[model samples]
Target: MPLAEFDSSVGHSFGLEFDSVLIRQITEVSGLKMEQDVIELKQNTADGKYAIKKLPGRPKAGEVTVTRGLTEDNSFEQWIKDSRFGKMVSARRNGSIIVYDYEGMPIKRYKLINAWPKSLEISTLKAGDTSVLTEKLSITYESVEVD
Candidate 1:
């Protein structure tokens, strides 16, 4: 493939899909990390030396963060509020963050399953600043599927 072709696919344009809705105002999505535990074992060698062996243990998914311009809709806030009021199980949701090409086609997608809001922060307000208010949402999910 040519440089131009690869460049387009790596473009910054992307979308966040959740609750059957596409959030186009998202400015950034990050913190998709996966890690596994390593179990080490020591064994006796023929030369009277000890050798270490490593084995995979458990898998862990890190938190995912989504930042976007603050909107009038209070859906995210409501979900957090509900979760705090003994509705956490019901408030959990599944979603996906998709990276798109210059032509607006999806090139990659990170699917979030059984996700729920772990934290939400509204941008700080300044007297003379003209920047728009943005909300940062951190989510915790059971698993992540990449496609």
Candidate 2:
């Protein structure tokens, strides 16, 4: 199981628990941050969806997008904004950190928490460039989303 924490000083503490593949995905995804150099500090989780995004910069000209095939836009939005699992992950990012998938009309959106190890104060202070964040964490699923 993957685990992460928040410290609050020098930044927060994140206990990243990724297998092997997941570790790779996160590294690749973290690099996908629509923005350049930003830090995510919140978190949120759903049954099958997970997003950890940095809150910086607006949606550039071209960005990746996600849409629901069978899920209703309102319901899916509600799911991503769920209080328990969507606290810091709310699509609103109202108070906590969040990731917005704004592409196309209606714009399918999800929540983004700060799941990056760069936010940690331990040894992993840099983005996904440190050994502690990359070598230590592992991924369980092959399709696990990194945001």
Candidate 3:
């Protein structure tokens, strides 16, 4: 494949999709439901309102896990650290998409002292869209804990 073709698919444009179960989990945490095709949403409102309200969580070393996406690259990490998703524990583990959590759990309970740091989910869409850290992901944190 030429550099152009590969670039288009990788390190290029973006798309979006939100699974049902994931939406529910977010809704439980955030009180709002996001559709799969949701390409973008705000984290901090235009008027300075936090898009996804913060919630409480226990404090401890968290755990982050994910079924790595094929097209994923270092850009994802850059975006994570740049935007609302602040610096994580360290380097993102290869072959796996880790979601930070607490005390050996997927969602470490913590007050949103700093949004992204406290955010449960940090996602940058295929395009320029982004799913900032919010309460919905925190619900996912709790749900995953239950399962």
TM-score of each: 0.87, 0.17, 0.18
Q: After superposition, how far is residue 118 of candidate 2 from its true place, in Å?
A: 23
Write one digit per residue (lDDT tens) for candidate 3, span 41-100.
Answer: 448878887786445444433322222232323333443454444343331221211123
Better of 2 and 3 by TM-score: 3
Best by TM-score: 1
Error of 2 at 98 (Å): 19
Model 3 scores a TM of 0.18
Better of 1 and 3 by lDDT: 1
Q: Report, for all candidates in order, the number of backbone clashes.
A: 0, 14, 13
Candidate 1 residues lying further than 4 Å off, grouped into runs, are 1-8
lDDT of each: 0.82, 0.27, 0.28
Decide which is better by lDDT, 1 or 2: 1
Give the number of the best model, judged by lDDT.
1
Please state the error at residue 21 of candidate 1 in Å. Answer: 1.5
Alpha-carbon lDDT of model 3: 0.28
lDDT of candidate 1 at residue 9, scale 0 to 100: 62
The CA lDDT at 96 in model 3 is: 13
